[model samples]
Target: MSKARDFILDIFMPTRCPCCEGFIKWDKLLCEECERALEPVDNSNEVPPAGCSAAVSAFKYDGAAKQGIYALKDGWGISFAVYTAPLLAEKLKGCGADLITCVPMAKRKANERGYNQAEVIAKELSKLMGIPYDGGLLTRRTTSMAQHDLETASERAEFAKTLYGIADGHSDITGKKLLLADDIHTTGATLSECAGRLLSMGASDIIAVTLCRTVKEK
Candidate 1:
């Protein structure tokens, strides 16, 4: 399908709010109420993932924020990135990031879904931040356990090492700060693995930025 034709078709179709199913503008993913209900994570202090120097999230993965990310990941088309990019870009001010990249989806899964929401979000953010968005910095070699499917975080940690493979031609990462973006951060296993892989390639630092993050339950 041509992107031009898809864009035209999307314009005629009514985009519904992910939560309420009410009509919304093509660029809007959530209605006013759903949008207002989300709370930004207090990213004032750098919350680094286990293997990375710093990390941040735009919203806590609860209520509307969770629903919005789900819609972006599964329910809607690529347009959801249009709505989510600004939410992350506005929060990234002053973070000295040299380049931008995103967690990679398996080739089969990405083909089945037709798009990777994380890469889309990252590219949109790159456009806003004026940083490079390299969709090929990392590739998913194996489809590992969904973090939520695991009984504990330890199990998630054990499976992380086999999940990703670094790409070639990325050796320029040596001593450069990198911003890794994703749609959500649950146990941080995925982000941690990707960050460590880049670090091994001589990247100096990694600042992971997720659009949503799951708050641990007591």
Candidate 2:
């Protein structure tokens, strides 16, 4: 039934590559050219966010990966999340996460975008990894400036400190190992802030994962 439904959807709305916006085979995530252009990251030596036990990211935030993330953020290509989740899941194998959650957006911002892309990715990841997903595990405080608007890592980190809070019904995460998902990791400020909040709520540990991470210049 699922395959049949997908076939029908593909017939009417052919799946396009999120990065290039070019037609792609229904089962493919990216056009061959775009896939070839992506730079896979080696995050083995990367440090985790301040309060996270570990962290992993699939691709560097450039070229194809950046475009795909923008498409999902703008609500144009949500399948980007579906396709990217598997890559993150593979990297996160043996992470020991009991529950999966995402870096939340403010209600107003989420309503404006129609959905939170991070949540979409986290939910898909939960299905693939056989972990439970809790969409409301955290909430973002309304803010005047978006994280990207902050220029420096220090500025982003300071702004992020007041950005997140534990959701009302999820205050007690005692002993639960969490997987925190996000679309991008630039300076690690936001993920660190979110992980700190979870840890304060008694979460035993957190593993952070993102679809893309900004590559530092060599």
Candidate 3:
């Protein structure tokens, strides 16, 4: 039944490049123009959040990365995950993760959006890594404002905390290495708060992976 469903969906809904929808083939992530506009993130220049053991993003969040991310998050361009996840997974190769998980969204918000973009990307990452993904391991509360909506670091931090908790009766992660996924990393407040909650529940390590990381505002 699942195979049939996927086959039907594939026929009716073809994948398109989020950044250049009209200029790409089905298997391409982006057109030549959009690809050339991307500035890939360098590992040495990247910085992790307070509670994260490490962090990485596949591309610097600008130009094509910016357009692709928005299209995936708000424009039903989920196929962007197929092109983006492989790049992100390459960064996670050496990071010994016991399991994979995504920075989850609140139930209501996820319902409203039809899907969580982070979870979509995470699932693809898990497949590429041969890692297990447990999407139900965490829960969050919807916030009135997104991290991008907040101006100060303190405001973003406050909203990030108390929003996620280890799922009830599923808290046996002592000494386990966890890899958390998200669509973008800006202030890192959101992922840090999620890590804080898991570490308090006995998770030994947390590494964050995101599709893009924003350029710091000067």
Candidate 4:
């Protein structure tokens, strides 16, 4: 019944590939060409940010992956979350997370955007992975400059520290293992800052996951 409904809807409101904006099957997230262009991340070389026990990402922040992320952020392709969650869920198999959470967006920014992309992905992931999700695990302290605007890693890290705090009534996560979700991983600064807050609140461990990550130049 749902598939029939989706097919009917596709006739009028066809699902476009998030990366290329080309018409695609109602059930597909990316066109074939865009899917082929994705570069998977090498998890063996991934280094978790301080306070996080592990970090995993599905693809390099380039090509189709970059466009897909941008699409989600700009509110054009929310279905990106439905496509990405399963991949991250596979990576997180055996990661014993008691709760799933996400990097918080400032209230002002969330209001303007009408949704937090990170939270959207996290909730989808929680449903797919069978984990409890807590959207209120953290809160943004201020509306700071966007992380992409920071050029250097040091600058990004410093600015991120001032952005997040444990959400009210979530002070004691005692012994809970958490999985943190976000749309992208650049310098890992924002995830690190959030993980630190969770650790300080007594979380036993944190595993961070993202849809894509910037590949550092050697």
Candidate 5:
């Protein structure tokens, strides 16, 4: 179970990078060069509210990171999750969360994709962080139009209401510090909507983390 053994095993198992499609080193989920290329989102200045003290993101949703996320989302490349989760975990240490919850896809998309990429990342991070993951605390009631295609923030947030946590009686989120994971954040509308829902559920704390955030154009 040495890192080198794992890397060799991974190569033989063919878990290559989705972007370059090259063999990834075992000790690193992705080649070190690629990791260095990713630009992490700096959230040091934003003063988040009580429940949402702050958020961290490992990369701007551009360049290699964008390519990696696209490959995973469009091509069903699961291997990308393996490498990306650690970067997220590193940003998340000491964030203070009791449980991990991911931004869920609408049932329609879930049925189509056969998986939720965010959920996959959250599960992987939960394992790495040794924290329990709560997959059922939220559920997407409906699918919204693709945010990328939309041009306005209001349109995006309006589209986001279709997503709602299934808060009937599955579990109580009250007083729990929750971490919400997503693949990308554009205008923060999507994350804000989900955070709003968590707050309504009486979630004591919420942290919005994403693998990447779409860099706004000037």
Candidate 6:
């Protein structure tokens, strides 16, 4: 039955580059150069007090990376999650954990989009990493104002105050490792805010993995 389902999907939905909209080779998700182009977030010497670790993105958010992210978020190219998950997995090599939690959306956005793109990436990453995925650990409240449009760090900090965590009474993660997943990382205000929430909840450790990271021009 599973094989039949895959066969049907293959025929009806051929995989393609989320950016270029061209066919992605059967076994390869992104082309070689695309894989090498991702920039890792700098956590080398500036580790957080918390045991949290992070893997860099495969591409800097520029040409192809920008297009791929925009395609998934705006173009409704949901299958892009499947193609990008393996790359996340490769960057995540040697990291093992008990639960995979995704960056959640505001309830309204999730309902309107019919899904959270981050949740989709987390599900695919779960399959690749052989870890169970949980969507309930963190929840986002109503939409905060756009962070990009803000002119000052104070404005960004004010927006960060809007993100809060809601726990669903599930398995306990105290002393257990967690892989926090997301689709992209901008100023990281969102991820940092979420991480702060998790630490407050007794989550012992965290490893953040995102499909892409925004590069600020110097």
Clash count for each candidate, listed in order shown: 0, 0, 0, 0, 1, 3
Q: Ten consecutive residues with minimal summed lDDT in candidate 1?
A: 75-84
Clashing pairs in 1: none
Considering lDDT, which of the candidate structures 1 and 2 is the better prediction for this target? 2
RMSD score of candidate 3 (Å) = 2.7
Badly placed stretches (over 4 Å) of model 5 are 1-14, 22-28, 31-33, 46-51
Tell me the tens digit of each residue's lDDT in model 5 across 24-136.
Answer: 65554566667677776776753342346577677777877887898789745666677778877887888779999888787778778888998988898999998899888
Clashing pairs in 4: none
The TM-score, computed over Cα atoms with residue i paired to residue i, of candidate 1 is 0.87
Task: Please give, for residues 1-218, the per-residue lDDT of candidate 1 as tens digits.
Answer: 46666457658887687655678765556788877887767776545777777777877888877767777767374544566678778877878888898998887777767778888888888999999877778888746455567777779877777778888765477888888988888778888999989988888999888887776555
Tens-place lDDT per residue, model 4, 1-218, is: 28889889999998898887899988787888988898989887898888888889999999888889888888777766677788889988988899999999988888888899999889988988899998877899655578889899899999998888878887457999999999988888999999998988889999889999889879
RMSD, model 5, all Cα superposed?
Answer: 3.4
Candidate 5 positional error at 184, Å: 0.8
User: What are the TM-scores, per candidate, against the unseen true structure?
Assistant: 0.87, 0.92, 0.88, 0.93, 0.82, 0.78
- Model 2: how far residue 104 lies from native, Å: 0.7
User: Which RMSD does model 4 reach against the true structure?
Assistant: 1.8
lDDT of 6 by residue, 145-182 (tens): 65678877567767866866666785567776788777
Overall lDDT per candidate, in order of appearance: 0.77, 0.87, 0.81, 0.87, 0.75, 0.69
Q: Candidate 4, residue 125: CA error in Å?
A: 1.5
Ranking by TM-score: 4, 2, 3, 1, 5, 6
Which scores higher on TM-score, 2 or 5?
2
Candidate that would win on TM-score:
4
Q: Estimate candidate 3's alpha-carbon lDDT, on a 0 to 1 scale.
A: 0.81
- lDDT tens string, model 2, 13-117? 998999999998877777889878888889887788899878898888999889999999988778777767888899888878899999999989889899998
